[model samples]
Target: MPKPTPETLARMKDVVGPKGFVDDAAEMAPYLVERRELYVGRAAAVLKPATTAEVSAILRIAHETGTAIVPQGGNTGLVGGQIPSGTGEEVVLSLSRMNRVRALDAGNNTLALDAGVTLAAAQTAAEEAGRLFPLSLASEGTCQIGGNLSTNAGGTAVLRYGNARDLVLGLEVVTASGEVWDGMRGLRKDNTGYDLKQLFLGSEGTLGIITGAVLKLFPRPQSLATAFAAVPDVASAVKLLRVADAVSGGMVTAFELVPRIGLEFVVSHVEGASDPLPDVSPWYVLIEMSAGSATAGLDETLEAVLAEGLEQALLSDAVLARSEAQRADFWRLRETLSEVQRLEGGSIKHDVSVPVSAMGAFIARATAEVTRAMPGVRVVAFGHIGDGNVHFNLSQPAGADKAAFLARWGEMNALVHGIVREMGGSISAEHGVGQLKRDEIAATKARVEIETMRALKRALDPKGILNPGKVV
Candidate 1:
């Protein structure tokens, strides 16, 4: 692919106007690098179009000139899908300036907003309207709805409400050809033809640029019951999840797994973090149950579930949050585990998922294999266990060089992913496949499935200018 000509770049800048384009190296630095710093990219410019029309105009120009465009949102992605290429041939089209709350129909339980709206802001908007936007993440404050939609982000609430794709009712996307496809309808049931919005939900900007969305909302919970429990092992934790769901009458909203080592990492690195339980356990499960009615007896349900878990030997110990602050403290441990891992030297992270029945076996086998493969490597396995998605991370051995441990990234991923595949799990669960796992996915995915993805890419983005060299 050829680089965008100076004239083409000029026209692109003119389309966004002065306040929307960034060309200075210093100003573009943040957009070029991701949080993990695994991959750094170079872009000719970063375009921040404030409106759909502006984005359409820019894409129209790029589509005509065949200029590569990368749609970026909040830059909070772990995978390098949002980053431009190292060749400096692409332009980062940022949706940050398009922040807006288009509409909120509380009666219909729908919230429509610009894709650039922060996840936190979207949640706040829904709350102010007496509704709940259930999709959440650790980076909710900085991550944009566009990025969340693009990645199909799955967070703590996914166990109850489903992933990002499930929360969205409609999407307004800018196709690679610069034509705007307005499918932004705030309806619960529409027997429309293709369900086209599903294609871009987790496409990672390879097919189209998501500019606005109509998000599904639910009634805000009037009562919430949170607890931190000590499970003897992962299998016990899974059992506890079943009990929690049964006792709560399917009101269990979040069930997260945290290893003892992960808790130590958080206690050591994060301020105001401490173990909620009295005794140490090999594994911990954070359980949360929410009810829309204030008199739903969530607390009683949780207590009964815990009592049953103890009777069944599923829990060694457990503590229910007596206050909201304590509840927040319990969640802080799970939410901050990803960030605190950085303090523990090099960490090879794998965001994979296995069937709920095989999660324990998969983790045990993967842990044993990785330890045998690389002795002394610390396995900090934890995540949305209710959904069977675990952030199976391996911290470098004590006093080991970070670079050397990181160098074994590919080896570790292969070993872990093999076990995951054997157990009938997905290699990339919450995290989208970006440049990091782009090639490895092709090896694991079925030929027909991979071909189908490629065919879709060709049909939607024939020029291969939208986030090229990333997914597929």
Candidate 2:
């Protein structure tokens, strides 16, 4: 698509008024880049719409002018989905100004909020209502609910509450044609017709811009238990997860896999991080369980599972958090692993998922193949093993040139993704197919799937002015 004309840009800017947009290069810098700095883009302007009507107006102008509009939120996306392209012709539609808690229905266990509401803020709202919004992430403080829905984000709680799509009951979307589709019903069962909300959930802003959402909530957990266990290996960790599920009667909220190297990175680099267990193990798992009632005996349940794991040799050692502070400290270790990897040097990261049954094999085989291809490379494979999503990262070989190591990103991707394909895995799991893995998706997915995605994109965004050059 051609760049949006300056005249059209100014007209679009007027839709949101003066405070609604940013044109200065300095002011737009933050919106033009992503968290990893993997992709730096340029935009004609950054439009911050405060309301859904303003978003609709901006889209109308962009559609008429054939101008690309990249909808961005929080700017914390690992993939480049939220960032504009390098053409500098695209306009960024940021939802930051729309941050508002529309309503919280404690009786229905639902929340209606503008898309710009931060995840942390949403959680707080639910908490104040005596309910729980289970969708969470390491960037909860900054990542917006709209971006979470666009990317269908998966985090620690996904194993229990499901992905962002599952948590959302409905969406308020502004289509590429600048038409609003208000399907914001908070009903538990709405089989009236096509579930249109699913289409926009993970579309990554290509089909439409998510303006607001009606999210499902749950009873706030009255009892919570967290444990850090040292497993013998990946296989053992997988086995222990099943055991924990059975013993806890399906109370396993989050079961994360942590490689020895990743743990070492966190404890060594992250402040206030220490090994919970005394004895070292090759692999570890962070297991968390929650109960709705205070007398649910979650701690006892967790202890029983750990005891069985020990008896079966699934785990070598375990440490259960005794207090809320200790629980936070334990989580601090896991959450900081991703950021601390940078201190180790250049890292090639892959967020992929296989069937839970194949996670153990997939990690083992991929680690072996990557190591064989690049000797001395440190493999830091870790993530929500409960749902099979693994953030398989490769730290540059010790003392190796950072740029030279990063240059092989594609080579390593192919090497690792090859194993993923053989194991029937997804190339882009929780992280949506932004520019990073957009092309790779075609090669990995069946032709019918790609064609269908393109068909939807064309139908909703005929002008292709919405998040062009990303996703399908």
Backbone clashes in each candidate structure, one number apiece? 0, 0
The TM-score values for the models, in the order shown, are 0.99, 0.99
C-alpha lDDT values of all predictions: 0.93, 0.93
Candidate 2 local lDDT, 1-472, one digit each (tens): 7787879878987888999879999999999988889999999899999999999989888888788899999999988999998889899999999999999999999999999999999999999989999988999999999999999999999889999999999899999989999989999898898899999999999999999999999999999999999998888999999999899989999999998999999999987788898888999999999999999999999999999999999999999999999999889888999999999999999999999999888988888899999999999999999999999999999999999999999999999888888888888889898999989997778999999999999999999999988998
lDDT of 2 at 239: 94
Q: Write the per-residue lDDT of candidate 1 for residues 1-472, one digit (tens) a residue.
A: 6898889989988998999989999999999999999989999999999999999999889888888998999999988999988999899999999899999998899999999999999999999999999998999999999999999999999999999999999999999988999999987788968799999999999999999999999999999999899999898889889888787789999999999999999999999898887888999999999999999998999999999999999998889999989989998999999999999999998999999978899899999999999999999999999999999999999999999999999999999999888888999999999898899999889999999999999999998889999889
User: Which residue pairs clash within candidate 1?
Assistant: none
For all predictions, the C-alpha RMSD in Å is: 0.7, 0.8
* Runs of candidate 1 exceeding 4 Å displacement: none
